[model samples]
Target chain A: MGLLKKRKREGGEIPTASMADIAFLLLIFFLVTTTIDVDTGIGMVLPPKLEDDVEPPPIKERNVLKILVNETGQVLVEDQPSAIRLIRDEVKKHVLNEGVDPRYSEAPGKALVSIKTARQTPYDAYVGVLDEVWMAYFDMWDSEARRLGFPDYATYSAAVAEQGAENQIRDKIKAAISIAEPDKQ
Target chain B: MASSHFKKKTSVKQEIPTASLPDIIFMLLIFFMVTTVLRETTVQVRTTLPQAEALTKIDQKRLVSYIYIGPKKLDGNRLGETGVQIDDALVEDMGSVRTIMYRKLIEQPKLIVSLKVDQTSEMGIVLDVQQELREAGALRINYSSKREIPS
Candidate 1:
C-alpha cells in the first residue's frame, strides 16, 4: 500500500461569524430611525397643600366677565354675540366699565374676568383669547397707575392726557382700569 | 539503480484562506441588538382636535389629568350636551369641576391637567373645563390632538 491515500475528504464545512454582527447592525438601524410621541399644553399654577397649616385667603365672590366659545367657534360675552377678533377691546370695555364701579375704586383688585373656553375649541383660539386678556389687563393697569401718579407717571399721563379735554372721562377711565388688574394670590 | 528511484513525485496540497466575513457580520448584529431601545405604547383616550397653522412642541415631563366630555346619560339614554363627564357623571355646573380641579392642583402642584374632548363636543363644554382649570390655579393646561401630517 502507498503511504499517502489518493482520495481525500472533499467540501468541508466553513464556519461563519458574520450573522451576529448583521443582526446587531439591523437592530441599531431600526432603533435610530424610530420616533417618539409627546403631549402638549398651556402653562398653569397649582394650589398648595391643605395640610400645610397656612390659613386660606377669604373667598370673595367677584363677577368674572364670562366669554363663552361654542363648538362652531362662535364667541359669546355675557350671553351677547361678540366677534373673536374684537374680544380684547370688548373685554377691556367690560372690565373698565361694567365689571368695575367708582365705589369699589379703593379695592381695585376685586374685579376678575374669567375666560371659559370649550374643550373642543382649537388650541389657537384658546391661546388667542388668552393673549387678548393679557393685553387688556396690562393696558388697563398701566393707564390706572398713570392716573394715580405712580412712578413712570409721565408716559402714562401723556397717553391719558392726549385723549384731551375729558379730565372727568380720564378719571373714570382710570378707575375702571384699576379694577381690571387681577389680585395676585 | 536510476530506474528503481524513478518514482512519481506527488505535489504538495495547497490550502486557500477564507476572508473573516462571518466574524464581522456577527459583531454588527450584536451591537445593534444591544443598542436598540424598545418602546411601549401608552393608554390614551380618543379625541378629535382642532387644526392649527402653528403648533409648538412641549418637552417637559408633566402630570396630566384626563377630563372627558360627552353626552349626559339620563336613565339608559345618553343626553347629547357639551358638558364635562367626570367619574361617569355629567357635570352641568362649572363650580363642581372647579372645586375638584383646585383640589387636584393642591395635591399635585406640578400637574398639567390636559383636556381630552371629542371633536363633535361643543366649544362651551371645553371652555368650561378651561375656566375651571384656570380658577383652580392649574396654569399649565394643554389640549390633546392627533398630529397632522404636513402634506
Candidate 2:
C-alpha cells in the first residue's frame, strides 16, 4: 500500500480558485461599463387632474384658431391651403383680428389656439409647425405689450429698467398666451 | 567477494495528470453564448432615418405611432393607373384621430407618441403629424434612428 501511494504522486495541482476570481472580476467589469438603451418618442405637457367636476372657463369663439396638417404635409389654416412661409403671418392675423376681451386682457388663459396634425407627417414638418406656433405666440404677446405702453422687447435689460425683475412680467405674458393645442401624433 | 556483489539499485517511474481548464472554459463559454440576450432591432416601420451630428438620449417607454407613405392606390390599383402615389391627406381634417390621441394622453400623461416615417414620405406628411401633436398638448417629442456605424 505504501509503494502504490508513492507511485500515485504527480506534478503540481492547477490553481482553479485564482482563475475563477479573474473570470468573476472580468464579468463584473463588463457589466459595470455596458450601457442600457432608451426609446425615443413624442414629448407633451399633460393637463393636471381635476378632483371635482369644475366647469372649465368659457372660451371666446373668435379667440380659438385651428391649424391643420394633412397626411401630405400641407398646412391648412381654416380650410385654406397656406404655404409654410405664410403660416406665421396667418396666425398673427387671426390673433390680432380677435380683439382682446376683459377676461383675456386681465388673464392670459382665455386665448387658445388648436393645432392638429396627421400621423403620417414627418418630424421636420412637425417641428416647423411648432416653431411657427411659438413665434406666433411671442409676436402676439409683444404686440399686446407694446399696445399696453410697455417695451416691445421682453428681455432682462428692458424688464429690469421698467420693473424690478422681468421674471414676473415674463410669467404674466406666458400665462396670457396659454397654448391650448394638443398634439395627436 | 561480498563487496563486488552489492551494486547500487535504481527505480524508474512516470506519471501524467489531466488538464481540465481548457475543457471547463470551453463549456462555460458555450453556456453563456447560448443564454445571452441579443439586441433586437426596435422600430417596426421601414425607414432610412436622417443622420444627426448630435442626438439627445431618450429613456421614456411609451407607445409609438408609425405612418408609411408609398404610391397611392385605388381598389388595389395605383391612382389614375399611375404607379406614383401622391400625398393628399390634409391636416385640418384630423379631428377624429386627435380625439383618440387626447383620450390616450388623458389616460397616461407621461405617454410619448413616436412618429416613425419613411424616408420617401413627403415633408408635408411629417409636418402634419407634428402639428397634430402640438394641438393635442404634447410637449415632449423625439425622433427614432439607428446609430451610424463608422466604417
Candidate 3:
C-alpha cells in the first residue's frame, strides 16, 4: 500500500523547475535576433504619362523658380550659379513673396519650384537639392502654424487629422514642386 | 549565545517563491515571437541610401514595395555595373520593369514604390526606371533615405 501511494504521488506532478530556464533561453534567442527598425524616406508622387499630342500647361517664367543640377553636382537657381545651401532661402523667399518682388512669384499659389537635372547628375546631389526644397516648405508651414496659434505644423496637422478636417495651411500654401525630366541621353 | 542564534537562523527553511517566474518568462517569449519577422528578402546590391532632413515614416509595411538600384555585387567583393533589382531578379531589360510593376499594381492598387537607390548612382538609370513606373501607373514613389543627423 505504501509503494502504491509513492507511485501515485510521483505521477501526480511533473517537474516544472526548469521551465523558466527553457523559456528564458528562447526569449533571449529571439530578443537578440529580432530587428524592428522602421523604414523612413522622402515621399513623392510622379506625374502620370502624358499623351503625345496633348499640350502641357504653360506657366509664366517669372512664377517659376528654376533649379538645375548638372553632371558635376553644381547647382543653378533661376539661371544663376548658386550653392545647394542657398536653395532653401531662395525657395522660401519666392513662395512668400506676395508679389512684392517682381522677379519672384505673383502670389504664393502661383509659385512653382521646378527642379531639372542632367542625365549624369549624381543621385545624392538630386536628393540634396530636393531635400532643401522640402525643408523650405516645411519651414513655411511651421511659421504658418505658429501664426494660427499652434506649437508647430506637425501638431497642427495632427489636430486637423483627428477632426477629419482639411489641412488649410497646406491648401493655402501649396508645395508646387515639379521634377522636370532630364535631357534625353 | 551569538553563535547559537546565528546557527538557529541559518537552519530555518528559506526559499524564494518562483511559481510565477515561468509565467513571466513565457509572456515575454510570446511577445518576442509575435513581433519577430522571420523571413526577410536578401538584398543583392550595395545600396547605401542618401541622408536627408525631410523624411516621412511609412507606417504600413504592407503597402510598400522596394526597388533597389545600385552597382551589382560580383563575386569576391567586386562590384559590376549599375543594376536595378525588383524582388529577387536583376532587371536585364529596362522595358520589362513596366510589366513587373504593373502586375504588382494590379495586386495592390495602393502600392507605394520605395526607391532604394545608392548614393553614387547617376540620374540616368533612375529616370529610366521612373519612366517605366509612370507607364505602369505606379506613380507614388518614396526615395528611401536615412535621416540626417543635425550638426
Candidate 4:
C-alpha cells in the first residue's frame, strides 16, 4: 500500500521551467509599485483662530522669555546673541527659575517661551532653536521623575511602571512654547 | 525486522528537485506585492528636510496632507523661484493654498497638514504658507524632519 502511494505521488513530475519568469515578473511589479517613504514629523497644534477682535489679555513681562531668530539665523535670547546649543540651558533656567533670577518665571506653570522669527530666517535655524527648547522641558521632566523617588526612571522603565505618576507630571507642566506673529519684511 | 524486510533494492535516478523553486519565489513575490503602497503623486520641488531630535510620529496616514516647499528642482529646467507644491501641482499664488487646503479639510476633518520644507529655504515663504493654512482653519501642522543630523 505504501509503495502504491509513493508511486502515485511520483507518477507526474510537474514542469517548472517558467517558474523564474513568474517570480521575476511579480518581483518587478512590486519593485515598480512600492512607495517606501516612511513619513515621520514633529507635530504641533496651533492655537485656534480668533473668532473676533477682542482685547487680548496682557502677559506679565517676567513670565515671558523672548527668543528672536533673525534673517541670518542668529538667535537672540532677550537681546543676547545666543548660540543654538545654549537655548536649552537658557530655557531650563527660565522655566524652573529656581529663585535665581527674578526677571525669569516664578514657576514652570507660569513660564512661557515666546519664539519670534524673522521672515527670512532659515528653516533649519528655526527648527534647531525649537528643538533645543523642547529638549529643556524633556530633560526637566526626566529629572523630575527621578527626583520623585524613581531612581531608575531615566535608565530603566521605572516611571512608566509607577502607573501614571511621570505622565501626570508631564501633563501638568507641558511645554508652553508659543510662536508670536512674525514681523513683515 | 520490518526495516530489513522493506530494504529491497530499487533502481531510481538521483536528481535535484527544481519543481518547487517557482512556488517559493512566487510566495516571496506575493509578500512584496501585498506590502507595496502605490505612489499617489510625483514630487516637483527639490527639498532636503531639516533634522530634529524631538520628533512625534503620526500613526494614521489617512489623516495627513503634505505641503512641499523648496527651490524648484535645480537640475533640469529651473523655474528660477522657490515653489510650493500641494497635491501634485505648483501653487501660483499664496492665496490659492487656503482654498485648496480648505477643500481637503472638508473631506477629512482630522487631517493634519504636514509641512516638508527644505533646510536652506527662507522662513518667510514658510510663514506665508502657515498663514494661509491658518486662514483655511487647518491648525494642525507637522514639521516633517529627519531624526538625526547627517554627519
Best by DockQ: 3
The sequence of per-residue lDDT tens digits that candidate 4 reaches over residues B1-151 is 8776556533345688877777878887888877675648878887889999877787667788999999887566664578999988999989999999999999999989999999988888988898888889999999999998657
| TM-score against native, each model | 0.39, 0.37, 0.88, 0.79
Q: Which stretches of model 3 miss by more than 4 angstroms?
A: A1-22, A25-29, B1-14
lDDT of 4 by residue, A58-77 (tens): 88898889999998888899
Q: DockQ of all candidates, in order? A: 0.17, 0.12, 0.70, 0.54
TM-score of 1: 0.39
- Measured against the true chain A, the candidates' chain A TM-scores are 0.44, 0.51, 0.86, 0.73
Cα-lDDT of candidate 3: 0.94
lDDT for A71 in candidate 2 is 65
Q: Could you give the CAPRI-style class of model 2?
A: incorrect
lDDT of 2 by residue, A106-165 (tens): 234344556666655554565456556656666766676676676764654366667665
Estimate candidate 1's alpha-carbon lDDT, on a 0 to 1 scale.
0.54
Residue-level lDDT of model 2, residues B41-67, one tens digit each, is: 332233455432223345434344333
Q: Which 10-residue window in model 3 chain A sums to the lowest lDDT? A: A7-16
True contacts kept of each: 0.32, 0.22, 0.88, 0.80
Ranking by DockQ: 3, 4, 1, 2
Worst 10 residues of 1 chain A by lDDT: A175-184
* Range of the 10 consecutive residues with the lowest summed lDDT in candidate 1 chain B: B37-46
Better of 1 and 3 by TM-score: 3
Which of 2 and 3 is the better model by TM-score?
3
